[model samples]
Target: MNIKIGNNNKISSSTIANTVNGNMEFPKKSWYEKHPIIGGIIVSVIAGVILIFSFWADIVKFIEGVL
Candidate 1:
């Protein structure tokens, strides 16, 4: 199949398919494969970081309004 990029900035469909095919074949198990506890800890830490950053913006907005 011939795939064309509209603006010449996109990859061809075959390239995408080839790159993603291996990932699609296997279920993602890296999150719990080696060590469940460590994986959970890592996930929790990442989630906490994201939560903190998310609220940081709100905190900044509140501070701006108050000041």
Candidate 2:
């Protein structure tokens, strides 16, 4: 967002912050938002955990057979 403050000066939306009660209000970015890849990583980790839990008996049986 390009805002024309004057005849020549241009201000962008990224540089703007709302101030309240003598405090600057900045946009809060979430951890996942900052690192988008983390979302995929988290989903993959959850799927891996679910798979491991679901196949726990089979894994144990295979390990026992191998032993």
Best prediction by TM-score: 2
User: In terms of TM-score, how similar is model 1 to the real structure?
Assistant: 0.34
lDDT, candidate 2, at 60: 87
Please name the candidate that would achieve the greatest lDDT relative to the true structure.
Answer: 2
RMSD of every prediction: 18.4, 11.8
lDDT, candidate 1, 1-67, per-residue tens:
8766765656554444434434556566774795899988999999898877777888989999999
Candidates in order have lDDT scores of 0.76, 0.81
* Candidate 2: Cα lDDT at 44: 95
Model 2 Cα lDDT, one tens digit per residue, 3-36: 6685577555554567547676899999888988
Clashes of 1: 0
lDDT of 1 at 36: 92
Residue pairs with colliding backbones in model 2 are none
Model 2: lDDT to the true structure: 0.81
